[model samples]
Target: MIARLARQLGKEERDLQVLEAVLEHQPIGITRIARETDIDEHKARYSLRMLENDGLIEPTPDGAVATDDVEERVREINDGLDDLIDQMESLKDLDG
Candidate 1:
């Protein structure tokens, strides 16, 4: 089975919303993320748990500390998608 290392990248609308809120307010809690995102606390907690499991974030004595390199990870995803777009464009030449 292929480990979907990019779970959030696809089913991420909700997760992205939560991540953005967390990034802006690191060491925050599910209650805060829930309030800001209008998501229920349970959903917010689930998103945080998934992100933490992927090493994309963490929880500490203080609170949830988003991964320091989350932006970097986002960049990497963008770069990969850009590369994919370039590849697909190349294939369009054959269709035309």
Candidate 2:
């Protein structure tokens, strides 16, 4: 069960990385975003499009910029991750 949850979260982290890269470096290009995040262009584009569709990012004349809601979502994702980590650490001493 923990392994399955970890796999899910690993995917979420990738999406979050794409979001963060766009928010920080935009007006930023996909190639550059790929380099910054160490993700391939294909993955970068996929994330960009998803975020745009979700209203988390905008493709401006400059580049893709994160919307206000994106930041809030990112914050929430981060906080939830912290809580998960704490739970895992606490459970380390327990027998499964």
Top-lDDT structure, candidate number: 2
* TM-score of each predicted structure versus truth: 0.68, 0.67
Scanning candidate 1 in windows of ten residues, the lowest lDDT window is 1-10
Reference-based lDDT, residue 32, model 1: 88
lDDT of each: 0.79, 0.82
lDDT of 2 by residue, 1-96 (tens): 879988877766777788888877878878888999999899888888877887888888877888877767767767987998899899998986
- Lowest-sum lDDT 10-residue window in model 2: 68-77
Model 1 TM-score, all chains together: 0.68
lDDT, model 1, position 93: 90
RMSD values, in order shown: 5.1, 2.9
